[model samples]
Target: MKQVLVFLTDGFADWEASYVCAELNKPNSGYQVKTIAVDLEPKTSMGGLRVLPDYDMSTDLALLDIPMLIVPGGTGWSDPINVQAKELIQHCFEREAGVAAICDATTFLGRHGFLEQHNHTSNSLPDLKLGAPNYSGDEHYVEAQAVVDRQLITANGSAAVEFTKLILEKLNVYQGEVLEQWYGIFKNGIISA
Candidate 1:
């Protein structure tokens, strides 16, 4: 199975990527999920949940043939430690691979000029500009729950379901009516036949 690399760091929001990871594991979803960190040690989430990563950033990700990268938001994202995460996301983008981020993690992209040319959004435009003062994509920002520009996907913290739906759609894990039905069941509690 192809791997989707999810970057983890201290104070990471546990809710952002959970649905996407779970949905990607369904039969024929065409992907498996792996967590990566700066090191091999365990990291704690904002809610105090601990998770051990499957690999570290130094693990030669290119050789692993990773095609997708997911980054969840956290307070730690504003730290200098996020440089590693930025590098990884940049590498994925240069390779034309899929990149997804939510909440504050969007600032990582904004700070580095990644979103300067891509239509995107974050927890808020002001917050994103606060993190990356040089960000020039202000006019491209949308007020929607989630936004996708080519291989890059972004969302706010409260838009996890919509975020996951966009990722799944980008990955072709679900599409058209099937995707809508899935969203209905999960987002609205209405099961479809």
Candidate 2:
């Protein structure tokens, strides 16, 4: 089973990762979910859930099969004082692993120039620019719910469903009409017998 690491921090938007996580954690999905954080301390989500991470910045990545890193939007990502988050991202990128970010997490990636070479999306082009003063990827920025390019996934804060769908597609967890059915049920709240 491949391990999917999810980075958590104080004020993480729980709903942002809820759908994808739920699916990822389902039995026999060929993937497993693991929580990681800056430290071993429990992180609180925006929706008031306290999560105890299974791993921290100190964990050895060589021991894990990291296919992707998912980060939900949160208040902590924009801080100018980063711990090991940037290093982790660089490490993942170097290994050609998938990097997914939503909302402010996208801002952090933009701030650090992580989205420069890839097509990405965020809260908005203007907001991304404003949040990430170092960002210069306007030409690569796509205006959409979510975008996947060069193994990177980015989504606006409101694109949780889209984000999950894209992640599922990229991970090969669902495809074709099966993928569309999942999208329709979640995105449109439609259910068929």
Candidate 3:
């Protein structure tokens, strides 16, 4: 089974992570989703929801054989003084894992030299100092949204549902109508061939 690790941090957006997991768990989807945090203890989200991670960052991530690593954006990524969170972002890029981030989480990618010269966006604070080609559109959420650059897959905001579907398509778990249905709901229109 293909495994995906969602890196949870303090104040992480619960919706993004939950939506991604929920979508990936759909019938016939061949993804094993797991949550990881900097530690094994329960970490809280911005909504006061606490989640117990399956593993710690210190674990042998390379050996875990995760093909993808997702990072959900929240106010936590904006803190310039948080070194550990920054380190986790660095680890994801170094591992050559299919990386995805939503909302303010994209800033973590930008700050760590991952987004340089790449096209991306976020729902976090606008007017960021990122060196990349920031594509901040007015849409509250992007549909069927993913920037497939090299080994990275990024989407903006709570569009994690669409992001998950994109990942499934990439993994050959779903395609054609199945993937179209997933995209239709969010894009407000059917995805035609």
Candidates in order, TM-scores: namely: 0.95, 0.97, 0.76
Give the whole-model CA lDDT for all candidates, comma-separated: 0.89, 0.91, 0.67
* Native-to-model Cα distance after best TM-score fit, residue 106 in candidate 1, in Å: 0.5
RMSD of 2: 1.1
lDDT per residue (tens digit) for residues 1-193 in model 1: 8999999999999999999999887767889999998888899999999999999978887687777899999878877766888778878988999999999888888888889778898989888889889899988899889999999999988899999999999888999999999899889999976
lDDT of 2 by residue, 1-193 (tens): 9999999988899999999999998886789999999888999998899999999989998898899999888888865444468888888899999999999899999988899999999999999989888899999999998999979999999999999999999998999898899999999988867
1 or 3, greater by TM-score: 1
lDDT of 3 by residue, 83-150 (tens): 45556566666777678777666766665656654555554435334422354432422233456566
Best by lDDT: 2
Clashing pairs in 2: none
Q: List runs of model 1 lying over 4 Å from the truth.
A: none
lDDT of 2: 0.91
